[model samples]
Target: MGAPELMRVSVFKRYLDELAPLDESDPHQLPPSLLQDLRRFKEHGRHTEPLEVLAASMRHLRNVAMHLQDGERVLPLTLFPRQCLAHCPLSLHELLQLPLDNLQVLHVEPAVLRPPGDPQRGLVKALHLYHPLPLLSWEFAMRGSREQLLPEIAGYAAYRASAVLDLRPLPIPTPLRNCVRRLQRETTSLRQLSEWPGLDRAVASRLLNALYLQAGLIVSRSHPAADTDGWF
Candidate 1:
């Protein structure tokens, strides 16, 4: 409603110039694929558009460019559907530039750290090398939507192994209240929490994503059973 954060006017204008043919006199023009990306950029940049859609458009544009150039897959990042970052310390622009691998390292449990020769390690190395531009754009898009996207930065697999979740005081939906109350009584891991009555793996993941967006969830890097006394 206000202004585009990730897709600024100046930046968009510059991109337009870059994609333009250097010599208009030359019959050659921008590639059809590149033009499609540019079209998406313009469509999403409109002030009336929803933030989530804009973010997705930005991500799409980036992926199109990346694939056309190198064929590398640019993974789509998820964000909490109800996140609010009005007072966040890190701006969307700044977060977009950070290394995704570093964020993953911070979130990943030590026990689950992939060995040097593992395929997971190769994937991480690839993400680091490619710069995670699409992921960052998705994050930027999430910042704009605030609630339309899921909140968690890392993928489900990243936290499946050693992640321990602790409940914090925050507004919760009526449907999840009882489940959350039980969690308050005892600490749980993603796997354990998902197994609870009425909560399947996908539901559990979405709830956690929502909690993360509200900044009302604590993710302990320690073993899930290390401090099983009570919610901290």
Candidate 2:
């Protein structure tokens, strides 16, 4: 049988109504004044691009539905901003400079950090300055500095312990690849010491002593327990 006819207006109106109680109760919903503005748009048929706006709205609603089905509670503030911009001819710069109080959501991604002085830096800083809203969870990936992006010796230590430290496959820079291989060798030696039955105390002590010395990149002797305890 053919699929049942879709209730487009009812579905869209239902989503808007679901969002309406917040004005009277939660304070985060769009104000009644903004709903009045939307009503004006509807009355005057001022939407020169109604189909485009509707498409954007439907997409936003789909994203909300998917998140809800996943048991996620946070509604993205981006939906309203995206809807507003859909039929508007604003550039990214114009959109970024719009008063933060007028914006619903601000999404940031790692690539925004790459260019350093990209216009997005101002937008990101402004968003932090104006909106006290908790950043959407996806924003976390954009939080780290470049130095924190590198692979760490501790990961190779775990790989070595698991007997899986294969250096040939990693497409790392030559110097870093050599460094990791050397660290892997030290990890393998430590694992060998751990393999001995009953672990001779003196041998284990010597092995641990050697590991302590060679583990400079992975562990700090001044703070040995800090590294081993995974505090980083």
Candidate 3:
């Protein structure tokens, strides 16, 4: 005997069904329409990108911050996969690193502030923005109104020499050994970084995308350095 058998998955499911009333008939599933994501993902019916959604959300949060009344405070919104609602959330360092190829991202906006004492606030399961980061590196998750390219950071391939990247305020990725010594001192465009570093275009592109969300590296679309040469 295997130390007393536990309930089967089917049996556990039955227990779950019994826990909820059949009359209610609520599927308890998030609506696909509620999904917020980049136009590219939605156009292709692809999975939502967590960092893209989060970085975008941070811009909206700034508006919420502006509306704060005297003594009112901005509450941290929790970001996580639809299925993995944890107790609390703040920073999205881990969320940014999620395997987002097939997962739906969801967030919780605080509703209790308006109602003052809504009991539902606690019932809701789903729940910032920049700093010096010497104490916290690799934490760009910036809150600002800016645009970026590269649909996915892990393997984004659309690198252009014209796109200027500023890593002065950010930590260097360990793979590129001298990134700290060179990139941190001044901003460099994609072309310069690749040629000087002797980095393959693809590797350099990945580096650019990884830093896209952080405020430190704003690819100035209007800047003379902006990439116009069809994707590298």
Best by TM-score: 3
lDDT for model 1: 0.36
- Clashes per model (N, Cα, C within 3 A): 8, 0, 2
Q: Rate the local accuracy (lDDT) of all candidates.
A: 0.36, 0.28, 0.36
What are the clashing pairs of model 3? 108-127, 162-225
The parts of candidate 1 lying over 4 Å away from their true place are 1-173, 226-232
Q: What is candidate 3's lDDT per residue for 143-217, written digit by digit as tens? A: 221123344332212223222544554545555636534555545556556676556554555455545434334
* TM-score, cand. 1: 0.30
lDDT of 2 by residue, 31-139 (tens): 4443343344346553312212222233333211111110112112222222221111233333234332222111110111111233556533222222211121111
Candidate 3: C-alpha RMSD after superposition: 12.6
lDDT of 1 at 57: 29
**Superposing every Cα of model 2 onto the true structure, what RMSD results?**
22.1
Candidate 2 CA-lDDT value: 0.28
- C-alpha RMSD for every candidate: 16.7, 22.1, 12.6
